[model samples]
Target: MSSKQGGKAKPLNQPKADKKEYDEIDKANIQKKKDEEKMLKELKAKAQQKGAFGGSGLKKSGKK
Candidate 1:
């Protein structure tokens, strides 16, 4: 009978997450992520030092 009821119903609010508790697994995972990030940085530096990957892969001849 009400206008609100005739319209779409509102969604229920989601429950908030509780405080995070870091256990041994969490600590190990975090360490692994850090190691991966460090390795990525090193690899990026090496790539930059080496210059662009293999250039444009085409040789331009001066002869027409």
Candidate 2:
């Protein structure tokens, strides 16, 4: 009979992983994505400021 409650036990000491070095192209791609996100945020803000669409109900004319 096992008294352990969890599924598996973890190791006491874990080795650290090496840091990844980005190339020029990778860096450029990352920067491009960030710029795109920024532009999208700006556009969204502008749209919100403009407010929602006009009334959906029927329009009434000036004539009786």
Candidate 3:
């Protein structure tokens, strides 16, 4: 029942290491995510326009 065995008393004075440099990869991943999100949004809009989920049923009202 010792406190040492219970994992206590670690001060928050440890120096944290810097993140690894993967800027190019990170940028590409972020761009990919943005593109994916944009595509999904567009698809959702298209599906809604087609009344895929019985949205407003106004998709065929033809106001455009």
The numbered model that scores best in lDDT is 1
Predicted structure with the largest TM-score when compared to the true one: 2
lDDT (Cα, tens digit) per residue for candidate 1, span 1-64: 6555666888999999999989999999999999999999999999999886887767789998
Worst 10 residues of 2 by lDDT: 50-59
Please report the TM-score between candidate 3 and the true structure.
0.47
Worst 10 residues of 3 by lDDT: 52-61
lDDT of all predictions, in order shown? 0.91, 0.88, 0.80
Candidate 3 residues lying further than 4 Å off, grouped into runs, are 1-22, 53-64
Q: For residues 1-64, write the lDDT of model 3, one tens digit per residue.
A: 6545555767789788998777888989989999999999999988877764655644465586
Error of 3 at 1 (Å): 44
Error of 3 at 33 (Å): 0.2
Clashes of each: 0, 0, 0
Report residue 24 deviation for candidate 1 (angstroms).
0.2
Candidate 2 ranges with C-alpha deviation above 4 Å: 1-15, 54-64
Higher-ranked by TM-score: 1 or 3: 1
Candidate with better TM-score, 1 vs 2:
2
